[model samples]
Target chain A: MKVKQISVFLENKSGRLATVTRVLGDNGINIRALSIADTADFGILRLIVNDPDKAWQILKNNEFTVSETEIIAVQVPDKPGGLASILETLEKSKINIEYMYAFVGKSGENAVVVFRVEEIDRAITFLQENGIRLLTGKEVYTF
Target chain B: MWNREMETIPRPQLEKIQAERLRKTVERVYNNVPFYRRKLDAANIKPEDIQTVKDLERLPFTTKQDLRDNYPFGLFAVPREEVVRVHASSGTTGKMTVVGYTRNDIGTWSEVMARTLGCGNVTEKDIIQVAYGYGLFTGGLGAHYGAERVGAMVVPISGGNTKRQLQVMVDFNVTALACTPSYALYFTETAAEEGIDIRSLPLRVGFFGAEPWSHNMRKEIEEKMNIKAIDIYGLSEIIGPGVSSECLEQDGLHVWEDHFMVEIIDPNTGQVVPYGEKGELVFTCISKEALPLIRYRTRDISILYPDVCRCGRTHKRMNRVMGRTDDMLIIRGVNVFPSQIESVLLEIGETEPHYQLIVDREGNLDDLEIWVEVSEKIFSDEIKKMEELENKIKKEILSILGISARIKLVEPKTIARSEGKAKRVIDRRDVYTK
Candidate 1:
């Protein structure tokens, strides 16, 4: 299932991220998986939340600018070569991954790997055609 | 039926006057003002090229920075001995804009002042109370000289001493007043408090300028003082306040196009705006002998109206100035000027127009904040009344200005009052170089 991730734009003013996090926490929007890309002056907090649409609305109402993107969620066994195997499959499909991160499954039986890819729709189609099971957002985030 | 300029002759006649003036002025500049002659040589434009009125564009536009860079005396077209009257703008950054007027130039000034006074319906019997400051500021002398030229008895009450200002108005039976719009309101309020019979006072009209004011503000002043508030627009570089004045109809200030050529142009591109669009105002003073400025870029933003004015004077009128291009504060991609804020405050009724534009650097970007003094009687006796009034004012200011101004209702006169032109901006957004 495709889930939209909201990337909250934040500047690194001492407690800016904490203020945003506190604001989100106060609004009761649960963060599912989060990754931060930061520079000296500012940072982008990309979050997969329990209700991204609601969280985005809340942030926007507070005058925070939020943008969305689709990320690949792959299910891997709790074994060493699982990530390597997925990368090899993507290479075989000639799909180059831009950047990636791993989210340990909530129940720890497996890991949900997320990737920023050059072609997200084609990667999803190629994986489905190759019988590679993509993790359901519910299974990866709430299992 | 009311389409001709009573003062203006035919086009060829006007061109002949301009060419003769331009030739004499160019010769004067080439001989006396080395900087201007140098600039002309650099541009490969000789003094002979400026023989026609159409060649005005060939000359370069002078800027505020040019005045600052030259510091002083670098732009005088005539010798120092020939300069009879001198004035300068109160430059906050460096030096000051030094302007000179020869005896003939002063005559032109007085003549223009007479024309401006003609707009106000002043007769030789009228008592002119010139309340604007008399220093280097062009307001007082502009009105004073005009009153003198019109053969009216002059009371040169050069600004301040509001108590005496009222006293003379009542004592001398002053028929007309001239000052900045804000200070005029201050006088009205003071006159009201003292229970001085305003109706008994002979203030039939007021010539308000040096800062932008709105129709609502003018109406308020008119209603309070029982006088019509006519706008007289000018700057130090362009021979001051007599440059334009609103006729009795209050249509717009009619520019005295005979001695001066007025053009509105793109502030950045210097491209001339068509007759009806708003742009930066540029003035070419063709007649002044001491320092005739060729296309001096007055940073004030305005639009030219070539429409036939109801007044018999066919001189092209400029819409009451909206704001200054230089005074504009670009905040978060929004262009906000203090004049716009003042108009917003005035339109809403019962809001004091004391405002300071405060801009600061927040994080890596610029943050804008505005501090406005609350009107004397905001409904703030109860808690709910205070909050409600604040919200109302905030919403109104926001609706007109586009950017949300953090409205702070400081006590009256809390803004360091300037007897002359009020300082509108306090920008502190220096780029942090780390």
Candidate 2:
């Protein structure tokens, strides 16, 4: 299953992160999950949002460099070996993950793990065939 | 002195030779070159009418556009067989300003270069390294011939390769260096970085030219490299790197009056100015055969001191070239036109037209950073995409300008817009200069 994520480019100036979030918040767009990749010169803010298309539009209107990327969200058992098991399966299948982040689901027994990989369709087919639960975009957004 | 008789020749005798050479040069150009013949005819002046250096004012002035109009070989006075060498400068509009030299002309250049190197006290005992770039540019070979003429051990180690340049300077015990003043300072920094003690090296004299530098830069170079930094001035169109040079006195560069007739004219009015007045420097190549340029306007702004120098040279001297009437930036001895930068940006189609070039001196080296505005569509949130665009723009600029620059992409509206002509460059190094 694939989910839509919005990313914004921010120059490493003071209050740039605040500016990006303020722009999205002012447009009534809620950020569900977020991660930041930063360097000395600039930073990239990635967000799983309620409406990624609306978020991209509002950020673009605010003159922020924003893009939409397709990522997969997997349901884990919230155990110590949950992420390790999924990673092992992906490794065996020769699927490389670009980046990953996690959030605990409302059920408290499972976790939602977001992944960015180059081959989304192959990873989806492999993971589904391996009996790994892949949340749909609608389910991830609602969660 | 390389040639004591010529260096200290009396003013009257020098002027006499200048007058005779000027007459011969004008007569040759009038009969051979159609461009000069037309120019002289349009000015209603004949070659016989030019008997003295003072009579040169009556002739029509030649601009760089005239050279471009002539193109590759349109202004040569001699046949193609007699021409020995050719040099060119990057043209403003993508065509080169080409110049040629005959055997005798090369001899004249070498002679002037000998005098120039001799001014820096380069003797037969000294080991000289010519660090100026060789090829179609006049810097390297010009210094090479001059160093050889002085009977010095010449090392034809052209430009770049900082590590090798330093190693050669140490291993060969180089006593003299001929390169751009900025590069000499850059070498000093690199030597220090490599744990080499440049001050302990045998570098006694440094002949630096091909770009305008300040007296403070002279001090920096001398103290850092422990060498006597001498300023040498010339252009490819006007016989390359040995037109004039500062003697030991370091007051002004002595223009060998016997070969070149120098004049100062107000750039705005195009009229001759009094001696010691600041104006555009013009030269008439009295001894040049292949390219006998007459009243060729050198856009460099400086004053002329015809008085004899304290170093006992009776040749007329010109002050250091300070500013230019036009916008030509000399970055690390490379000629960079702002229009070239604009053309590269337009060709890449990644950035907006609004850009600013920030030039600064970082640790005695010239640092160039170009601030280009990116269109909203091209600005990518992905780090790899953004870095790719930056590298692409940098490669394009380097290929077009032949100079490296740090590419900085800013927001579209960050650069201030102008109502008239845009302000393209912010030179922070001007504070060190007058």
lDDT of 1 by residue, B40-92 (tens): 88889888888887777778888877877777877887778988888876343
Give the alpha carbon lDDT tens digit for every residue of B41-98 in model 2.
9988989999877798888888888999999999999999999899987776567789
For all predicted structures, in order, the TM-scores are 0.58, 0.80
lDDT of 1 at B158: 89
Candidate 2 wrongly placed segments (more than 4 Å)? A1-9, A23-40, A43-143, B30-49, B65-71, B92-95, B162-164, B190-202, B350-352, B416-422, B431-434
lDDT, candidates in the order shown: 0.74, 0.86
lDDT tens digits, residues A14-71, model 1?
Answer: 7767877888899998877788865443455778777777887887777564666677
RMSD values, in order shown? 18.1, 4.7
What does DockQ come to for candidate 1?
A: 0.01
Query: Chain B of candidate 2 versus the native chain B: what TM-score?
Result: 0.93
